[model samples]
Every structure is written in structure tokens, then in C-alpha cells.
Target chain A: MSIEHRDDTGDRFGMWLFLYTEVILFSGLFILYAMALAKFPQQYAEASHKLNIYFGSINTIVLLTSSLTIALAVSAIQMGRVKHCLNLCWVTVALAILFLVNKYFEWSAEISHGIYPGSEQLAEMGEGVTSFFNLYYFTAGLHGLHVLIGASLIGVVAVLTAKGKVTSDRYTLLENSALYWHLVDLVWIFLFPLYYLIL
Target chain B: MTEHKHEPVPYRTFIQIWLALLVLTGVTIAVSRVNLGALNVWVALAVASVKSSLVIFYFMHLRQESRLFKICLLVMLVILAIFIGMTFIDVLYR
Candidate 1:
């Protein structure tokens, strides 16, 4: 019986294809956002003013740095620097957690002010404000979920890397996970301006 | 199967890219405060598109990927653009 070997290129190709589908999924929400903005430009702009750009900007830098760390981790493994790769993976996870922590505080502030999705105050503000919060919560919440998933995937890959299961020759898991992490960062790149800065 | 050689990118390049992204974030924040009227959204989106391209080309190593992968990504983006464009047509006219 002949055993088939693993194809790293094919593996990465599959990941990219899946990412394209994810892009299309998010594009649907973006279209909805654009339509809402066009319909109620003034109200959307006013609602956007309520967002704290400082927090959004900090999260952007945090995610961008994490993307670099994850990319460097992939480079480290490809060059047989397993320890370095593991350390970078840990840093990526820490940054992702920091992003979520910032998101928590930001959301807490908004919810405290009764500006969350489905809150009486937001709903009373009319359709534009209500739709703005709804899209804001949904898109950012979805991206946050991706952050948690990417961080956990990186965490598991880091353990495997430490155990030498993912070396220079067999590091597709690490590479694929890094790609996913970058996608999370990419999503946030658009989300930041769309939600926080476009007022 | 042809084995594609994996090159180890220099650590300095990653740091440089990170620094560039940070600077761009600062730029976006600073520009948002200037109140460019309706052009504000376009400027912000353009900056974001640049930032995303940097991540895609460098951090994600799309630049090093095979031509097939690049073509697939391009097609996907074109489709997304069409979707956004069609929606804008309806929204803008109505």
C-alpha cells in the first residue's frame, strides 16, 4: 500500500479559498453598512461621532503588531528557529487578548450609556442610529470572535512547535494559522475606519 | 510535485513594516479630526485600503505566493467590488 504525502502548497491554497468565502461573507455586511450610510448620512455621521477613536486606533496598532509577530513566527519556523517561533506566537496571542480587552472596555462604556444594540435609548433615537449600533456590534463582534479563534489556534500551534512536531519541514500548521491571524487583522483594518473614524 | 523554496524574511523588514503601519494609523486618526466634509469617508477608506494592502503583500506573504493564488484573490476582490458597486447604484439613486 502506498501512502500519500502531505502537500503544503495545496494546504495553503485551500486556506486561501476559504478566506475568500469569508471575505464575501463580510462584504455582504459592508454593503448593508454602505446602504445605511447613504440613506441616513447625517444620522450615521452623528452616531459615529460617539465612538472613541483612541480605543479603535490603539486596537488597530495592536492587531497590526500581532500580524507582524505572527508573520515573523512563520519565518522563524521555516528557518528552524522553533523557540523563536513559539515566543512570537505567544506575543501574538497576548496582543489579541489585549485587543479583546480594549473592546470589552469600549463596549462596556457604550452599553453603560444605553447605546447598545436593541437598547431602548438607541431604538428611540430612530432607525439610522439603531441600524448603526446594530451593524457596529455585529461586525465588531464577528471580528472579535475571529480574534479569539485565531489566538487559540496560534496557542495550540505554539505548543506543537515547542514539542518539535512542527519543524522547518512540517510547519504548514503554523503557516496556515498565521495566515488566519492576518485575516483577522485585515478585517479589523477595515472595521476601524468604517465604525470609528469615518464620521 | 515541485517543491517551492521557503525563504526566511529578514526580521528588520517585519519591524519596518510594523512601524509603517503604526505611522499610518496615526495618520488616519489625525486626518479624521480635520472634517473634510464628504471627502472624509473616501480619505479614510483609501488609507485603510493602503494599510490592508501592506498586510496582504508583506505580512500575509501574498507577494510570494503562486500566480494561481494571486489570480484567485484578484477575482474574489473583483466580485466583491461588483457587489458593492451594484448596491451603491440602488442606494445612490434612491
Candidate 2:
């Protein structure tokens, strides 16, 4: 078998294991979210409405574009275009930075406005609503942590590629890391609607 | 001709997948606007499932991958679905 086959098998197994951990990690927050939402359906709905859809939408678009960039990077590698692959990896990193910047602004604004989990704004909303806010912060905060980790993983791959550590045949790091990045993006795709667009 | 020449890479497939994702995003947003009551969760999850399948199939290259890998992934998701389903039952009932 070719190197790509072995590489693919190894990476797929590794990625699946990584994804299992991720499933467990996110399951914690999902359980809390489900319980909180069930206890305070209307309050959770109202709290979700307070979120800024414009920022959420822009972040989604950015993530989608990053996914495109990373996919193209993989394609470039398979086609034996090393430089193009590196360039696309950098583009994906840039988009991730854009996403973090947007998230920071959104979080800071929400915090300053006292929309934090147990702040007065939440207290005024009632205990059930306060619990919803609590879950929101916990879940979104956990997701943000994953985003940071994913960005760092991809950023390391980009830097390595830039330094010539990766080539067309030796790009498993990029491929696997990109798989992780896309999973992070996938989680947010569901999260955006659950947290931002619910009626 | 070589026995294993690579086909021209399907960049268009990626583009179409991206466009489909955007459409699904719109569908999710619109579906949320409708108050389906208990069914709203199913609608959202269904749209998400479609969006996820698109990414897994095209973006992640699962479609062109080995059958073993695809089967393993499906098994993983099935297990996840079972866990989520059981949790929701407890939440909804209790």
C-alpha cells in the first residue's frame, strides 16, 4: 500500500479517538444545557434572543471559509503543490484569528453589559433564566476553549509547513489538524442556531 | 496510461458543498422562526445532521475513504445518538 493509505488509516483512527474525547467533553455541557433549557424553556429562548445574530452569522461565514481554505490546502498538497498548500494553510489561520477576534468582541460586550451567568441581568431574569445564562456561558466558554486549541493546532501546522517541515508526502499533521479544525467548526454550526436563532 | 492516475481534483465539489452549507444555515434559521413546539428540537437537529453529513462527506473526504473508516464513523455517531437520546428522555421525563 502507498504511504497515503497508511497515513490515512493511522490518522483516521487517531482522529476518531480524538473525536471520542471531544464527544465526551461536549457531552458534559450538552447535558447541562438540556437540563437548564428544559427547566426554563421560555427564559432560555429569551436569553438566546439577546445574542447578536450579526456577529454569530459573520463567525459562521468565517468558519465556513476556513473550512474551504483548509480543504483546498489538502487538495494542493495531493497535487504536489507545496507552496500553494502553505499559502492556503496560512489563509485558514488568518480566518481563525478573525473568528477569535469577533468572539472576543462579542464576549466582552456581553460581559460589560452584565449579561454574564450570575450577574444582575441574569438575576432579574429569574432563577430559571439565570440557570440558562449560566449554561450559556459554560457551554460557549467551553467551545471557545476548543476553538483556541483548534486554532493553535492548525497554527502550528501552518508554521511547520512554512518552515518546510511538511511536504506533499509528509502532510499528515496538516490533514489531521484540519480534521480537528473542521470538527470545531461543525460544533459551532449547531451551536449558532441553538444559542442565537431560536424563537 | 498509468494504472492509478489520480483524477482531476474535484474543487467544484467543495464549492457546491460550501454553498449547500449556507443554504442549510438559512434553513436552520428559518426553521427556528417557526414554533414547532416539541418538534422544534427535531427540526434543528435534522438540519444540523444534513449539514454535518455534507461536511463529513465532502469536506472531510469520508465519501472517498475506505469502507472501514466510514463504517467506524457511523458507529461512533450511532453511539452518540443513543447517548443523546437517553439523556433527553431523562430530561424530558424528570
Q: Identify the candidate with maximal TM-score.
A: 1
Encode model 2's per-residue lDDT on A6-112: one tens digit a residue: 44456666886787678677867777777777777888888888889889889998998899889888888877788888888888888888998999999999889
User: In candidate 1, how many Å is residue A163 off?
Assistant: 1.5
Cα error of candidate 1 at position A103, Å: 1.0
Give the fraction of reference interface contacts each candidate recovers.
0.79, 0.50
**lDDT, candidate 2, residue A159?**
83
How many clashing residue pairs, candidate 1? 0
lDDT of 2 at A113: 84
| Reference contact recovery of candidate 1 | 0.79
Q: Over 4 Å off in model 1, which ranges?
A: A1-4
Superposed on the true interface residues, model 1 gives a C-alpha RMSD in angstroms of 1.0
Model 2 spans > 4 angstroms off: A1-8, B1-9, B92-94
Q: Score chain A of model 2 by TM-score against the reference chain A.
A: 0.90
